[model samples]
Target: MQKLRRYLALGGLSVGMTVLAACGASPTATTGPAATTAATTAAATARPSTAPAASATIAPAGVTRTASASVTTPAATATRATTPAAATATRAGTVTSGTATRTGSPTALVTPSQAVSNLQRLDNSRQTWAFTGFTVAGLSGNLNPVFEYNGGNQKVTLAAGGTNLEAYQVGGVLYVRAPIGGVIQADASNPLAAPAQTLFATPAALLTALVPANTSYTVAGTETINGLQATRYTASVALTDLGFVNPALAGQGGTAATTVWVDTTQGVLVALQSNITAAGSNTAATARLDVTQIGQTPAIVVPR
Candidate 1:
């Protein structure tokens, strides 16, 4: 699979106009900003009213008496009495509503590593997916592969040099569909056989090997891909994290801008893209992979 590896180099497979209407000239500035100011001098006299004040008397020992002039309306009194209870009820309702929202919406994965982990878990189940990838190393190539997994049986349609090659692995043997339409045992001679065996034989182990730990990433946003809602995450990952051992790239591992999409509903990995570069080399490798069809894919049937 040197051709495939060469095509996927980089640790392998680093894949308005808002219109505002003018409001009627502000009514001609409402009389030109109103007159500056006007003052008039006038004489006045102050007088005190002869209303009787509340009487207060000194009480006996251990007693106290005080007087004041304050009045409240019936509506004001009723409002003051019920305000606390109303506020308490509103607070309780708000808390309940917030809790419901948290429970109803899917919990977002805090880290990209967690998203990758979820991908592994979902990839192991009985599901189907199609991955389309493009890589640039020495040769620029595109790969579209559809995979179907059920229990321990799997089938895939691989793309190679404009040929749709079908492959099936059952009971520990890789079988390639011949041009004449029967099954052929895949040996070391076929370029795609080894890679297919390595990739499909162990479920999602390749994914674990592909994405590295210690990757710094953040949640980019949410997007819809292949009819599934997915959370997008962006990160900077070192080529070394992907197991790139090129002598031209060393130290800090030469970072790559990486982004991944995971299904918002089930946490399954939906898509990924990476742009990788070497330390001193001008050429860069770009790759993208997207998984679709999910649990709705048809069953894979071994060729009779």
Candidate 2:
């Protein structure tokens, strides 16, 4: 199994807007503006939102997004759901609705290193899980691209911005549900035209693309995301390390500080955030993912 080297698809996926510079390929995942674009474009089918898909890179967009997703289950996966707030180990009081809480417990899990080892182990094995989250990019525009992945034969849905840009994937086939448009089939011959598949082509592919490497993970304490108690780790990696090297971002030497939350009890990655900085800019490029569930995989069937 291949590791998620290029990691983040760090683009807001602006509908028609272009990023200052292009991103490079990383070792774990090869994400950039293109991935987000594809996500947004396909997601448009469901609603009006998301960036445009011209390639496989994550395009940076404006706006800060917390984790929320709408899977493809007819009833259970109908609406977007938020992570129930939990008390922080360092902060005080129980967090209500996305508010911060206080506590003092270290992030629970194996050693930070061990947590990563578990991540690697999971990556190497055949598994099923589900995730719902969004990525934020762009120094100016607030573009939030959302995606939901259900492993095991793979079922995914993507949407971004606030417009009706949405799409989904099942098996190897993809479908777009544009607002006024009917169901659009994905064309493998010209992937860029239907790059949404790049985001959820497979469980392993999606995990490798969504999860970061453990090389830089360090225990950062415990936090709650979506009502789940998860151990958090902080790390810093080069933009190129995750496959993000852009003339605007990496040209100035792209470096990112990331926070990750893992469900130690279940040995699964639950949530993560990345703050990317360039040598020449004051603004930081940020991206995030919050896993909604693991083990109890949801059913993601292809669209008709």
Candidate 3:
């Protein structure tokens, strides 16, 4: 079996929008601009003072083996073994040849070290930018989210009035706090370490981290995602460890395969799809992010 080197990169982006409009009741009688102005003023004065109203929308969105053996001889055969020496040598040679055939050439099982080196080098010099936008799909809700990072440190800001939530890292610790109601607070904690920190902490940050770093992964095939051509790379990896669907997630166990799609020319990841099989069933989820607009630089707040 060939030794396969697989790296699973995960992340996603979402856009949402909310519009506010102020409408005035039809004039009770014919009115000119002056009359309208007076009516507006009167209405303003008549209306009771109130706080600003806010709304928010949110879209939240890869193995090998080896074997060895030992041999032992009985103590009773210590004196007269010369007769079987020739036969033993022949059998040993055959066994060695058979083992080689069964296990395959050493080169077949090992990836060129240069590939790993290239991947790391590319990752080191990678350039990443931040993005913030509003996304709306029909009428589910509006998502206004912000992300900040230089391919590593990330913070996410989500605000939808009562559903305001924030997640970020500080001193390598991940903290997520959200309001359950008008005044209730809830929080969840994680190790906030590498790999996990890189992928789950921020979607944009993870995108930069997952870009192939000169690590040559065999292309699985080509498929269309959201009407765009996407290339899929298969890496031998553990899905759980990669943070695709871990126990921390509600229904993540038994995830089998993960596929990522990137635009061949732009080198931007357009979509990510994962198929998970748990409890004798299969469930799949997909995340799609399109760069409708790009910003000069993302505004991120790093927690102390």
Candidate 4:
């Protein structure tokens, strides 16, 4: 917590300045909400596969929000654990299901609820998966966070500048380790948990919010991403549908071209990409999150 505090303190003034500059400058920035939201939600593959060009003119579909449980985070502190001084590489996940279940036909359209439900269900099933992505907005540097989940166990490694923090939630115990502060056990009630949660929750929650009941998307065939075959869906939605309340976008009109990949058989979310742009503007912001190594991560036993 101390190291994280110091890192935030050092960047606080710079962050503020960057925001002001972004608001005044032209909108040609590569950073925006899409990046930040996906950062909390997913990752990039070390060996990425390209999808066909995505379009926003797909016929809109009628959809409604479906309730899903929030991904649980540990609430109690536990004994100290070994602390690594730097970020570590995570292996891709394996499929917990013996045979992945494919969903929808090549011609079938997908609803936002269906897409989100598959993601939430995967989380609930205790199926192991991992993702790594970076969030950047305004002039702030990118924050790359890696997340891995296995049943009730979860781990996240967040780094910015040279400060790195690792957190693990195994069963009911939570442990946080930073390069400078060693390790401390904490729960959801700890104030320090707030920032970590903010960084972690954005991706998953934002993906849900971004694909509200009004989205229209179609399957674009199956592609292999990090060893998993996932059906890709593409859509274009108004910025409002994505929970963006920007007055400028509202008045000027904006849209997001989104593409997502879901496990063919298991329906788990495999990757997501969104490009947001206001009409009549040359500038656009894009965000992407990719999940790999479903069911294959090393066990997250109580950190030793």
Model 4 residue runs over 4 Å out of place are 1-112, 123-139, 187-191, 241-254, 278-283
Instruction: Give Cα-based local distance difference scores for all models.
Output: 0.57, 0.47, 0.39, 0.57
The number of clashing residue pairs in model 4 is 17
* Candidate 3 residue pairs in clash (backbone atoms < 3 Å): 15-134, 15-135, 16-134, 16-135, 57-142, 57-143, 58-143, 62-237, 63-236, 119-213
TM-score, ranked from best to worst: 1, 4, 2, 3
lDDT of 1 by residue, 1-304 (tens): 9887777575342320111114334443545445322111111111112122112222422143222212345657788989999999999999998777544434363355666676655533333332222221211245555567655567876665656667888777788877674777788896657656644633353344335667666777677876777778887765543223222332534556777777767766777776766555654655556666666556666777
Q: Which candidate is the best by TM-score?
A: 1
Backbone clashes per model, in order? 3, 67, 10, 17
lDDT of 1 at 297: 53
- Put the candidates in lDDT order, highest first: 4, 1, 2, 3
TM-score of each: 0.54, 0.46, 0.30, 0.52
Better of 1 and 3 by TM-score: 1
Report the Cα lDDT for residue 15, model 4: 86
lDDT of 1 at 28: 39
Could you tell me how far off, in angstroms, the CA of residue 234 lies in candidate 1 after the best superposition? 0.5
Q: What's the distance in Å from true for residue 98, model 3? A: 42
Which model is ahead, 3 or 4, in terms of TM-score? 4
lDDT of 2 by residue, 212-302 (tens): 4545566766667656777777777655322332223323555667666777455566665666666555645556555554444456665
